[model samples]
Target: MNKTVIIKGMSCRHCAMRVEKALNKINGVEASVDLESRTAKLNLTNSISNQQIIEVIDGVGYEVVEIIDV
Candidate 1:
């Protein structure tokens, strides 16, 4: 499964890395973060809900503006 999440407060490469690391640590998550676009693309090995994704974002001190399947 794939997901695209729009994130807020990502102003630099460091912020992107932090978010990427946070997401990647979750079981079943493969993640890539784009600082320019402030977005994260995640590939999951199993089912995960929107709320769970949002929680991950929030847990890392970012706000999730949206999540899309692609």
Candidate 2:
């Protein structure tokens, strides 16, 4: 499944890269972040929960403000 999450605290390309790296560390995740939009789009091969994603983001010091179901 694929998902898009609106994230806060990303202010530049470097921030987006860090967020992407953090999400990619998840076993089944293929992710990318757009600095301009401050959003992270993720593709996954297995079932994953929003809480888990939130934890990952929070663990890396960013906050997830919204989970978009696209």
Candidate 3:
């Protein structure tokens, strides 16, 4: 399964990488963050909640603007 999360406050590659790393720490999740788009593409092998995703991002000092299953 895939999910696209719109994020805010990512100013550069480092910010993007931080978000990517945070997401990847979650079990069954792999993420690629696009700095230009302010989004992360998450590939999941098991069930994970959108709220969980949001919290992870938030914990890293970013905001999850929206989440969409794709």
For lDDT, the strongest prediction is 3
Q: Indicate the TM-score of model 1.
A: 0.95
lDDT of candidate 1 over 1-70, digit per residue (tens): 8999999999889999999999998899999999999999999998889898899889989999999999
The better candidate by lDDT, 1 or 3, is 3
Global lDDT scores for all candidate models: 0.93, 0.91, 0.96
List where candidate 1 sits over 4 angstroms from the true fold.
none
Better of 2 and 3 by TM-score: 3
The candidate maximizing TM-score is: 3
lDDT of 3 by residue, 1-70 (tens): 9999999999999999999999999999999999999999999999999999999999999999999999
Relative to the true structure, candidate 2 reaches a TM of: 0.94
Minimum summed lDDT over a 10-residue window in model 3 is located at: 30-39
Model 2 Cα lDDT, one tens digit per residue, 1-70 = 8999999998878888888999999999999899888899999897899999999999888999999888
Clashes by residue pair, model 2: none
Model 1 residue 60 lDDT? 82
- Clashing residue pairs for model 3: none
Off by over 4 Å in 3: none
